[model samples]
Target: MFQLGKTIVSEDIIEKEFVCNLSACKGACCIEGDAGAPLEENEAKILDDIYSKVKPFLRPEGIKAIEQQGTWIKSDFGELETPLINDAECAYVIFDKKGTALCAIEEAYNKGIVDWKKPVSCHLYPVRVKDFSEFASVNYHKWEICDDACTLGKELQVPIYKFVKEALIRKFGQHWYAELEKVAEKNN
Candidate 1:
């Protein structure tokens, strides 16, 4: 359903239709840390620096949320992975007394005290990046697209894509972007 230039995501890509049904579903993708994604070295550093600078301002609830969800651990492959969650929401996510889910990082960013944004893993849901080792590449797809009744499957997933792409470009410079373009072209 998300089409930008030649980037076309057809419904066939969906393996299941996830209805989101946030009221009951708990928005696991947003909160759960270790589904399967891992951060690149550059990404990890940027995230660490930004959060480190903002940590002091984080509310006590924010600290509790992070601790409850579990922190990132270094993988054998050297990537940072949050503990995989099967059903629990992310630790940093808190529901208001009214039951609306809240993002702690979004709160910090909105306060104007810190610009700490969501990490790439959090931004890109179904799509994930894996190092080629031989050469860098950008792999984009709707891996988690579902067919059941998920509103998100019919909605746009590209903003997340753009955010992830932009962050990687900013972190690694232009060559990385060029490689991404190449990978995209080859895949399409």
Candidate 2:
């Protein structure tokens, strides 16, 4: 097994263990960070189409990220740089009456207008297309792993398996499914 921060990659990376460190530390990934991933031309087209439809639901501040960065660009690592909202929070986050943040995309999915699919970046936190990229390797922001006073121990579980699994499937499709299945089987 290979452990990188809170992520534990058993013999194969696809079966990597991801435990949410939010309970142990403030959600640094969502609170103060930046993340970028490459988009194949087709993926870019799909994102442009979907984001256009969901644009209105995003806060003006959130929209600024898209405006300033553009939806896609060439990244330093040869991957495409996809803009993310402030601190990488889902563009869909909104405050409740009690002032707690809520995910708008999740809400839309619940309302049936959109499906459970989120942008690839959100689905693959801490990991990105670059992880699979032949030409690039993304470096996602990770503060939880760096926090000195974090409560989670060496073996703590991160609540990201299902989310990551869905994202990997969504981004890589069937070919990777078999590869990941092998990883899961060998590790589990």
Candidate 3:
């Protein structure tokens, strides 16, 4: 692991290759997870604020889940997360004509209905951040469901850090990312 500013990052983030292959995985990460996407404390308020605007883009089941669960819910571990439908797919998850899972919140953002994108946790898939008082631990999440993504990323020669650049910057800021890039360059 290496330190970039206050964040401790795992080497696997640079060593691993991963790009979401939606066609192959059909966005299983959204549907098959045991819990909804993790949310920051402030994200709950954003969900409540934008529910009406995002509702139209969501499925009935998703809408119902949100209404019943309230924008976000506390997980067993006491962390905030998006609501889930029957403890299955995320409440914010919508589907395209092809049945691939998509984020209604993001759809709203794309349409300019909301300024915020989906939760940073969802944006930074394969990279989970654990925040502490002094620093944050950033580590690559190895999930069997994303095996195809790893294969495709290897084929395309995209390292995990590069593949999730925007999200990383969004979470950690440009300076932190620039330092990470330097670390990656030196390591390579």
Candidate 4:
């Protein structure tokens, strides 16, 4: 691991490969997780503010869950997260005609109904960032559901850092991402 600004990043992000193979996993990460997608404090407020605009893009089940619970909920540990349906699938989860799970909030963003995309955690899949008092730790998340994605990424020769470049930039910044690139280059 190496330090970049305030973040301590794991080498796995530069070494491991992963690209979402949605056709194979059917976006199982959304439906099969024990908890809902993680959310930042600001994202929770954004969801509350934009629920009206994002409502139309959501599925009925998702809407029901949101109404019953709030846009976001506190986990047992007090971390914020999206609500859940039947305590299983994420409350914001939608499905394509092929039954592949998708994010309703992202659908709204794609349609220009909302400005904010889904939660940063959702956007930065397989790359979780944990903030400490002094710095943040960035690491790759491994899940069996993403095995197909790992295989596809290996075939495509795309590393995790490259695949989630936009998200890492979004969470960090252009300069931070550029430094990360230098680190990646040195490693390669």
Residues 3-73, candidate 3: write the lDDT tens digits. 88899999999989999999988899999978989899999999889999999999999988888889999
What is candidate 4's lDDT per residue for 1-188, written digit by digit as tens? 89999999999999999999999999999999789898899999999999999888788988999999999999999999999999999988889999999888899999888999889999999999998899999999999989999999999999999999999999999999999999999999
Cα displacement (Å) at residue 42, model 1: 2.8
Q: What is residue 148's positional error in candidate 1, in angstroms?
A: 7.1
Task: List per-prediction Cα lDDT, in the order shown.
Answer: 0.48, 0.52, 0.93, 0.94
Ranking by TM-score: 4, 3, 2, 1
lDDT of 2 by residue, 37-85 (tens): 4356665665566666556666786577776766555556666545666
Clashing pairs in model 3, backbone N/Cα/C closer than 3 A: none
What's model 4's lDDT at 52? 96
Q: Provide C-alpha RMSD values for all models, in order.
A: 7.0, 6.1, 0.8, 0.7
Q: Pairing residues by index, what is the TM-score of model 2?
A: 0.57
The alpha-carbon lDDT assigned to residue 95 of candidate 2 equals: 51
The collision pairs in model 2 are 18-158, 19-157, 19-158, 19-159, 20-158, 20-159, 38-80
Candidate 2, after superposition: displacement of residue 28 in Å? 3.2
